[model samples]
Target: MNTWRARLLPPALAIVFAAVLCSVVLLVSGANPLATLAEMIAQVARGTTAVDIVNTAGAYYLVAIAAAIGFQMNLLNIGIEGQYKLAACVASIVGGAISLPFGLHAVVIVVVGAVVGAAWSGIAALLKVYRGVSEVISTIMLNMLAIGVVAYLVPTFGELRGNTQGTKIIPDSGQVPGIPFGGAGTMFGLVLLAAAVGVGYAVLIDRTRYGFELRASGLSSTAATAGGVNSKRMVMSAMLISGAVAGLAGLPEILGRDHTFTLNFPTGYGFAGLAIALLGRNHPIGVAFGALLWSFLDKSSLTLDNIGVPKEIVTILQGAIVLSVVVAYELVRRRELAAEQRRVGRALGTAAAPAAAGTGGERA
Candidate 1:
């Protein structure tokens, strides 16, 4: 049941249910659901400018991977949206501040961006370690702070200034070029995200002894402490890693997609990332694929409706997909726990039976 394939099946089935429900919605709305779906298919075939979708989806992927890493440690980073906002602002300001060579400027900007995002999240980590605040609540509150502070900084000081908006478009030197043919830089964004995920898997799950300790601590923090693992350090490290990934999402906007920080750019990327993490079973590769599927549906929505499908139909289906995954994960988790308990009980019972029989034989 812990296998990726095993966990994936339930979500896949749920998606099928969602698709059927969407069809039902189309029928009830007096639309030719099949035709509507076909038109949507055609639009996807025609309108998908690879670079744009890939870039936007890359943002979603980075955030999803970040949350998924936290999830692996049994930590929930619900504040990635805030983390990204602050990080993007920091990156833009840093990029604009320096007049360095192109390579150094981009590197410095990205590093500062990642640092700021990590530092912002470190606040929540500090609270969890010292004040015993739940990361969920603390991060959520921190998100509010991030949104306000960045929102202020972008308009007031970031490059998008003068017109009461965010920073001006990032300089051409700071911007990463698109794939040779152009359109949007989404594919390039996706490539960077892939690299990030690979590095993340290596750093978080394999390369370091910390990965082993973190896994042990995540499964049972108290037991891991008894075993001499520094669970506190692992917690902070996990949070910092989550923040760094969130910051990388800014690359899509700052250097790839938008080329500048905006006051209220759509934050659906971060929100969708959370869902993708859950649907992906918190694994890096799984989350990437989950992000891809999520991005596809997102890109397809408007086109689908124009094909006669009602908005309510896709909306309900999408919502159901999340709900179904949540429910199924819970169910699967419960079953696994129950099975483990039963196995333990049987082992204990067998050991006790042997002891009792030996004692009785000796007494007789």
Candidate 2:
């Protein structure tokens, strides 16, 4: 098979298979799949629904890119959940306390979030590099630690009003303004930040020497070290970059929508990002599509209950898509490996035959 075909076919097939399977399931459960589809389509056609999808997708895009960075380096960095939360907490406090010019204040809050996230992830990186602690284990523990710290500090240092508990509201100078879309919806201005992050991620991973080193390290640490790639530094750098991007995952809500870190601030976005990253195969463009699809499903699911269709069907469909895509990709990878080995074997055989004939002539 052609290399590009091999790369593209699996994902395409996975989507088809998942859709067919979901249709069958819906039919078996006595629901009208076409009606359900129409409902989803009608709901998404609304301007408000479109705006909500874009707004949510912006956050998912940041989270997916963050996970993709670690994934490219073979790191899990499960602490993304904790990293974003902690960064948001600290950034909210700092942003609320200060009153600077609009642009500078926003920049400071973003910087504070990125720095705190990187610092939190650094703990897992150091443990992995120096103490041989598995990042999966360490990051998981760090997540719990982060939550505990946030819980403790919020009550002590954060402000609380009657029936509302959260950090102080950020002043207008620190808030991110929204772009109104014909009064039907207001899009978060931070969507530009998400776009910038995507562009930066693409450039960093595809065009830079450091990206080559990171890819090499992920492919084979021993080989990367043999080539003088400095595996430790690459691992640390990737982790920090991942965490820095993770920090932005919550900023759309914080700076644009919420203006403070409330106890009810969104959670679980990081875990959703992990799934999106997997679905995207860690590619920036792929991640964008994945984020949009995930967001669409989430938004469209809201209308499912109104039509007497189980909303849980969307959850099942999502799970099936992820599982199917993963299996398809793995199969493609193995097939590619086998094809490469066969090509190498044929080349070797042809070369050996020429050398053997030449040796026979000499011996004769």
Q: By lDDT, who's the top model here? A: 2
* C-alpha-based local distance difference test score of model 1: 0.76
Worst 10 residues of 2 by lDDT: 1-10
Instruction: List runs of model 1 lying over 4 Å from the truth.
Output: 158-164, 181-186, 334-364
Report how far off residue 318 is in candidate 1 (Å).
2.6
Query: lDDT tens string, model 1, 1-364?
Result: 3566457776787677777877777777788867876765555555344445555667778888888778767899999999988898878877766677776667777888788878988999999988899999998899889888987787677543555477666676777655544333235533575566657675767677788887778889999999998888988999998888788787766776567787756675677788888887776666777777777676666676555565556567768888888887777667777888999999999999999999999999
- Each model's TM-score? 0.86, 0.93
lDDT of 2 by residue, 1-364 (tens): 4767665767677777887888998999999988998998889877699889999999999989999999999999899999999999989989988989978999999999999999999999999999989999999999999999889767766788777678888899999998998846889999989999999999999999988889999999999999999988988999999999998889988899889898888888888899889888888888899899989999988999999999888888788888898898989888888999999999999999999999999999
Instruction: Report the error of model 1 at residue 267, Å.
Output: 1.1
Judged by TM-score, which candidate is best? Answer: 2
Which stretches in model 2 have alpha-carbon errors above 4 Å? 1-3, 345-364
